[model samples]
Target: MQLSETGRGVLVSGASRGLGRAVARAFAANGDRVAVHYGTRADEARATLASLEGSGHVLVGGDLADPGDAARVVDEAAEALGEAGGGSGIDVLVNNAAVNLPHPLAETPYEEWAALWQRHVSVNLLATANLSHLVARRLIDRGAAGRIVNIGSRGAFRGEPDHPAYGATKAAVHALGQSLAVSLGPHGIGVASVAPGFFATERVASRLTGAEGDAIRAQSPFGRVADPAEIAAAVLWLASPAAEWASGTILDLNGASYLRS
Candidate 1:
């Protein structure tokens, strides 16, 4: 089994802003060329590309909910970064794109609830599966070592009362990673996931500072939530060659807010 430890090509999905952006920055800072992928946030994606620490980074845009678009996103990223790495495509794939909208069973109508659940499943679960297959196939075909790190959520274990779809899909993601890790081990491919609690990201900045900020922070003994960069650091490590043995492991980044026995 061969595992690479030097500079590589990384593809970060949903990297327009927030945790995805932080993960992209972390990999770029570690000397990896990054392909920043976005759904609808083109300008924000460009900003993320600009913030990377090194060169050879590129921008890729596509709606991952669609299988065709998902394939295009991965192909474009590989084409763009392959040249820099001698035709060896992405060495790392970060499945960071997800949707967490509120659709409480008690409050939401049946139509809206079903729609939201389908949307969440498509973007959060199916897209991750599709991208993972695409990248893993390329690695296997090329006979190269690679890594796939999924961005799961604490809600997968703790439960999201108002967003059951989000929680359920994230749980599926965790399970998917474990299954892939086992299947891909023989190919020298490492697959792992991180389940993070509330973090300081642009998407939830208001919630962090508004009426529920105290309650949210109080959930963790640290009296504060995570910084996006903190989660990114964990992702960077899991993608490294040293973390090959950690495949199939789901590392929690919840700051002691949630625990599973």
Candidate 2:
């Protein structure tokens, strides 16, 4: 009943659908065991686990907005993936869980704007920070090497007029990853982040239709948005041993839609 003892244990947060699910699949296909974490979508998370290419994948449920719940989620993942004499069990931590809701300045009330900002900060920035700390601390104690790949957004560099909170928090995530990369590199733990533009995810299916979709596709010269698999592939590579040297890097997956000097 113990999962594959040969592969590394991977924990991917917010993996109920879209990019998170794609990332989980990529890791599973690479022969690693994945812990799929979901906040409010147990059924979707289960489906994600079922659709994986291999066995030994587990589902973890938690509302990461709460610090206590976040800690518990990390502990559960480590315990589930731990081997008889294995280290912390989880060798890779993917901080992919986030909330992106719109609150346009002029159109929203002050109270509503404040509440949305708080929610965004809790779910997107703080959860990621806490999870990274938990995983990195364990890896350091065990004297093992690991990787942390944060799912950031191109909105961080560009702009999210309608979703300012999302953009700001994602920028914080990217900064956090870079700082961790510098500090964790000495411990053989590489940390990196990927900032992606609009992608084909269920959450954005509505925006990718008809005239709106056409405008979005036109953002990139390629005349199309990215497939979730494309971003997942980059995440997979970043977690690989070969990518250690590329630590502290924030690879852009926006397909030239937004460029920064």
Candidate 3:
């Protein structure tokens, strides 16, 4: 289905780089006014804004790990986009900020292991929940139809031995999206998630170039990990009005890397 030419206000968290940046660009390309949200990376976020195709794009900065900051980020985005587009609130939200620090049980110490889990859960799960709630409320108050797309991980199903916390939080995110889909459907809001495996983002580019590259590629029959833009495309589709019935769905973008029965 083709997207509407009329511009909508979109807020993409973690838009400074990687999949977030790509998602922001994708929405902008479709004529939406986007709020590019970053965490302590103003320069990179500006670069993302500059790369977008349209005007009315704004830059918002906040650390998602802090609930207060997450709320503020949403408010700022809504206000900025509202001023630019003559709308009162955001039309779509993409929750893509997360922490993926590896803390292999065997090599890591107990203190660090515990810290890793806490940080990952705080940022990946709690923050997403907070932002979703804020955006949902705004959408409801404005009586507007909207979309929420959570960036999950294939590790949620396949497992992440080196980063169990990351996997657990992603799985929780998928579940959260499902719950929101049900609760918000009556209000004309669609909620869904995407679980991607081994994307070729800057954060993992070093590993993709090292000795483990081939093995990672072999995980998928395609013999290549996903490009950020591919993931961004899926996000765009899910956020479209055509995907309204797809609410509560968890779309897997793993390229057949880890099939779940």
Candidate 4:
């Protein structure tokens, strides 16, 4: 519950680039000792670590598709953050790593469709669940308060026709966060999720310049998509003690692009 200017230890997964990198920077700027976790981009992860405002940031690399690797990543992050913060365990866990692949039912073959579904479910849902469980267990054991912020997608509430698995997994993520919130609340752990619409990140830069750019922007009344920093700011706030009462909430960061009744 004590996250001061000398902030808490935080772990940001898949932080080599895009939204994950932005989230990492936000926490570091708040004086948190961050553990930047990446799947394959070592150089980019190192760059993220270097871009952190405060010192004591570390880099962790692992493929979350494997349950073992997911557990190891959390363990390594906890160890590194604890060492950096005078043996204090990680205070925040950001589940931002995911596999978002487009597989239109009309265009994709059955074999490829199955593979894509497996990949998406494994990384987006299973991996996140594993990480959350590990982190929650650690916090409970230590009798410490912590936070878990899941990075979901607007497609969960709206729709992703081309990437049905992505949408489904994100929906599952939101539900998982709520379930965890209820279960972990008594342990002083907060769990929440943010469902963001299209953001202008490196991954979708080309899409923003393509023929569908205008349509995408028009989805929001602002006439533009979200910026990475905006999503990062929401995440930073959600992971803070100030948002403890907001647990079990699946916050919408879609810029009014999609509203559900």
- Candidates in order, TM-scores: namely 0.98, 0.96, 0.96, 0.97
What is the lDDT of every predicted structure here?
0.94, 0.92, 0.91, 0.91
lDDT of candidate 2 over 40-158, digit per residue (tens): 99999999999998777889999999999999998888888874356447899999999999999999999999999999999999999999999889888877889999999999999
What candidate 2 gets wrong by more than 4 Å, as runs, is 1-6, 83-88
What lDDT would candidate 1 get against the real structure?
0.94
Residue lDDT tens for model 4, 1-261: 453434688989899999999999999898888999999999998899888998878899999989999889888888887743557668899999998889999999999999999999999999999999988898888778889999999999888999999999999999999999999999999999999999998888888876699899999999999999999999999998888999999999999999987
Model 1: per-residue Cα lDDT at residue 176: 99
**Candidate 1 steric clashes:** 0
Best by TM-score: 1
**Tens-digit lDDT track of model 3 for 1-261:** 222434988999989999999999999999999999999889999999999997989999998999899989998999999834556458898999998999999999999999999999999999999999999998887777889999999999999999999999999999999999999998999999999988988888888876699899999999999999999999999999889999999999999998987
Minimal lDDT window, size 10, model 4: 1-10
Model 4, stretches more than 4 Å misplaced? 1-6, 83-86
List where candidate 3 sits over 4 angstroms from the true fold: 1-5, 83-88
Q: Which residue ranges in model 1 land beyond 4 Å of their true spot? A: 83-85
Clashing residue pairs in candidate 3 are: none
Query: How would you encode candidate 1's per-residue C-alpha lDDT over 1-261 as one tens digit per residue?
Result: 365665788999999999999999999999899999999999999999999998989999999999999999998999999744566679899999999999999999999999999999999999999999999998998888999999999999999999999999999999999999999999999999999999998888889776699999999999999999999999999999999999999999999999997
Clash pairs (backbone) in predicted model 4: none
